[model samples]
Structure formats: structure tokens, C-alpha cells
Target: MFKDRFEAGERLAERLEKMGPFEKPIVLALPRGGVPVAYRVAKRLHAPLDVIIVRKLGAPFNEEFAIGALVEGEPERIVLNEEAVYRLGVGKEYLDRVVAKEREELHRRQKMYRGEENPIEHLSGRTVILIDDGIATGYTMKAALAAIREQHPAQIVVAVPVAPPDTLSEMERLADEVVVLETPEPFWAVGAHYERFDQTSDEEVIDLLKKGKERTEE
Candidate 1:
């Protein structure tokens, strides 16, 4: 288990350096847990950092268990975790309501943090690095990757500190290149590898994102 998120991110960056130069790499993190990792990456690579906003759709009663995710956009999408949703007895109507609720929250987050500014237009023929803490089901990461592919980056690299063997393999198939520092066999959960798995707030995510943007503009 890592002492904290920062340590995990540091280790991840070290592994990435061996891959190749990160010159002008756009480090994109899946907020809010991914922000801490990306912050370290941006620092180590001396590259611009940015956060891709995504909200997890939780079960009706237990809000922490993500049944899916809602990505912000026009005609916003609700990517459901079929396994979780079925386990939670989330039907189509229930799922639709959940999607709408999460979409509303997504709108609230963008308005509160990013204002009306659209994400940077993806410059084609450029490398893009996507960072997250860890992966299990990999649904959230899948959603993020799909969204990024829409932007048409020259390359997409997915990096993480730890992941299940299957989950890491899935990322390898989805991303142009996958760099997972550790793929612990018989994985249980992301929290198992984290010494301090505290919830990251919206404010912290925003602050880190602002840091990334300012660094890029410098």
C-alpha cells in the first residue's frame, strides 16, 4: 500500500520516464482522484496538466458505490455498469433518472469550477497521456478514453499505479499504449493498495486543474 497518493504518483512517473521523453506531453487526469497523480506527473515531466471531469453514478442507497459514470457534454451520456446496476436492481427508468441526476451534477461541477470555458481543443498529431490512480472494473477509464479518442489526439497513453491483471489488459487494448507500474494478481479493490484513500473534494480538483492550466500558459 502506498503511504499516500503522492507517493504512488511519484512511482508511476518514474516508470513512465523509462518509456520515453515526455516533451510537450499533455497530461490529462480523470478528476478528482486522478488530479493528485497528474499533479506529480506534470511536475516531473515539466508538462502542462489538465483534468477531465467525470462523475460516477452511484447506487440509489449507497452513493459511494459507482454503478456507472456520466460524462459532461451535449446529449450527455450515462455509461452504466451493467453488473453493478443489475446487482442493485437499477432498471431502465431508474437508470434514466440516475443519469439525469448525475448529468445535472456534472453541469453543476463544470459551472462551479471550469466556468464556461470549453476544454482545450485537442491538437491532432500530439501525444496525450491519461493518468488515474488505479483500475478495477475499468469502466470509468473506458469512458474517459472513449471521450478522448473523440478529440483525435495523435497518441493516447494510459498510466496507472496499480491495476488488476484483466483490467490492465483491457486498458492496453483501449489505449495506444498502456503503462501500468503494477498489476497485482488477484486484485480486490483500488483502496487495498492505498494507505490513505481519502475522498478528493471538488474544490481540490479545481485547484489542481487551475495549477495545470496556469503552468501550461507560463
Candidate 2:
């Protein structure tokens, strides 16, 4: 088990550095958990850091269960879990409502975090290192990958501290390269692997981004 998200980020950074010679990769993180981990990685690699806002569209009856996911980008992307949607008897009306709500949140977050910065414009033909704290269902990351793909990145690398073995395998097929620090078995939750798993706040995320911007400006 890792000490915390910071430690996990440090260890993950070490592994990525050994992989070597990434082509000016921009680090895109899935907030609000992924920011801290990605911050460490971006600092280590001297890469530009940004957030990819993707929200899971919860089931109509049980909001805890994700039926699909929405990714924010130039043209917003929506990825549905067909089986789940069908099994749950989810209709277009429900999906439309969920999509709209999530889209608002996505735009709000983008404005709050980026504030007119055109990072998306620079993504084309650049390697992108996508970071998250860990993976459970992996739907969120999958949606993120779809959005990144729209930007036409030169390469997409998915990096995480820990994930279930099966989920890691799925991610491998989706990403050009997958770098994980651990593929723990019987993974119940991502937090179980961390000694101190505190929830990352919006303030914390903004601070990290500000710091990252300062680093890039230097």
C-alpha cells in the first residue's frame, strides 16, 4: 500500500521517468482526486498540467449507479453503458436530462479551472499523459479518453497508482500505453490502497493548477 496520494504520485512519476523520452506530453488529470497525483507527475516531467472534466451519468432511480458518462471538450462527448442502460430500462428522456445536468457542471468546472485558457488548441499532435488517482469501474477514465481522442493527441498514455487487474487490461486496449504502479487483486476501492485518502477539495485543485501554471511560465 502507498502512504498517500502524494507518495503514490511520486512513485508513479519515478516509473514514468524510467519509461523515458515522452514527447512533450501534457498531463491531463481527472479531478478532484486526480489533480494532486497529476500535479506531482507534471512537476517531475516538467509538463503542462490541465484537467479533463468528465462526469458519470448516474442511473435515474439509483444515482450511485452510473449508466453512462459525459466528457467535456470542444464538442462534448457522451459514452453510454448500453447494458446498464438497457437493463435499467433507462429512456432517452432520462439520459437527456442527465446529460444536460452533467454538461452544466462540466462547463462550470472548466470555466473555474481554466478561465479562457485555450489548452485544447495545443493538444493536437501532442502526447497526452492522462492521470487519475486510481480506477474502479474505469467508466470515467474511458469517457476522458474519448474526449482526449477528439483533440487528436499524438499519443495517449493512461497512468494511475493502482487499479484492478481486469480494469487495467481493459485500459491497455484503449490507451497507447498504460503505466500503473500496482494492479492489486480483489480491489474493492481505490482508497483501500492508500494509508491517508483524503478527499481533494476544489480549493486544493485550484492551488495546484496555479502552481502548475507558474511552473510552466518559468
Candidate 2 TM-score versus the reference = 0.95
Per-residue lDDT of model 1, residues 38-115, tens digit only? 888877887778766677777888877788887764545557778887777888887778777877777787787678
Provide the global lDDT of candidate 1 against the true structure.
0.79
What does candidate 2's lDDT look like per residue over 58-91, in tens digits? Answer: 9987886778789876777888989999998999
lDDT score at residue 23, model 2, on the 0-100 scale:
81
Against the reference, the lDDT scores of all candidates come to 0.79, 0.89
Q: Per-prediction count of colliding residue pairs?
A: 0, 0
Q: Give the range where candidate 1 is weakest over 10 consecutive residues by summed lDDT.
A: 117-126
